[model samples]
Target: MTAAAALIEAARALDALGFMPSKSGNLSVRTGRGYLITPAALPYAETTAADLVEVDLGGAVLAGHRRPSSEWRMHAAIYAARPEAGAVVHTHSPCATALACARQGLPPFHYMIAVGGGGDIRCSGYATFGTEALAEACVAALEGRRAALLANHGAVAIGRTLAGARTLAMEVENLARQYLALRAAGLAPVLLDEAELAAVFEQFDGYGRLG
Candidate 1:
């Protein structure tokens, strides 16, 4: 699929999964000139490829009739900070947002936490939505990690492709759900240590690849 089509597809799919309640999330993909992002205030169900907006890193709208996502700055920041991030997925996914609302980061309570490119997923410091402060905070928390939780807001995931980023976003929600379940059951799950996590990372280096 074309980049714009893939972006809309991912957005609608995530929206259907309740990852973006009331159109509270955004998705973007890097482009030669800048990036293409979901338009603001539009439900994913009604969003079409034509609704996607292209904006440069300097935040100028280059194409499309609609305004880029209010959080476009956040996506730009991630693209600037991580050269390998070809796409970004930001969502107010329930379980993950619940933890972020508590100002809690996802600890390495499960080995799958390595999917985020770290031993744990950090929760960014609280900042007002749609502001550069929130963008800066998100970028800082994402350093050395592929995903991060926005304090009292949501979570963001980056990847080399839109599908990869979307899947990582889903995994973030899954991990959060599992962690919360353990906490709710009054079970303090054992977190993997650094060495153990490193091994998992090595194992993941070739995971899902055909030999």
Candidate 2:
């Protein structure tokens, strides 16, 4: 599928999953000149490929009638910083956003935490949304990681493909939900240590490779 179509498909799926409540999220795919991102203020269920906006790394709109997502700067910053990231998925999924609202990061409570490329998912320091400061904070928190929680905001995940990013975003929510449940039960969940996580990383080297 085309990047724009894939983006819309992911957005709608996330929307149905209630991740993009009240239209509070964005998705993007890197292009030759820059990236194509969801347009601002549009409901995912009603969004179309034609509504996707193409903007350069410098944030110039190359094509599209509508304005780009307000968080486009964040997406642009990520692409400029992480060359390997082909797509970005940002969401306000409840459980994760709840943790973000508390300014909490997800510790390595589950082995799956390693899916983010680290022992834990850091929460970026608080910042006003759609600003460069927010982008910078997110980039810093995502150092050596594929996902992060935006303090008092939401969460973001990046990957080499749109499907990969979308899946990681969902995983973030699932992890957050489980972590919160553990906390609610007054259970101090056992966290995976660096050594254990290292083993996980090694095992994950070709985890899904069939060939």
For each candidate, give its TM-score against the true structure: 0.97, 0.97
RMSD of 2: 1.7
lDDT of 1 by residue, 71-182 (tens): 9999989999999999999999999999999999999998889889888999999999999999999999999999999999999999998988999999999999999999
lDDT of 2 by residue, 1-211 (tens): 8778889999999999999999899999999999999999999989998889999999999999999999999999999999999999999999999999999999999989888988899999999999999999999999999999999999999999998999999999999999999999999999888899888888887795100
- Model 2 clash count equals 0
Clashing pairs in 2: none
The alpha-carbon deviation from the true structure for residue 190 of candidate 1, after best TM-score superposition, in angstroms, is 0.6
Q: How does candidate 2 score on lDDT?
A: 0.93
Q: lDDT of model 1 at residue 146?
A: 93
Worst lDDT 10-window in candidate 1:
202-211
Clashes of each: 0, 0
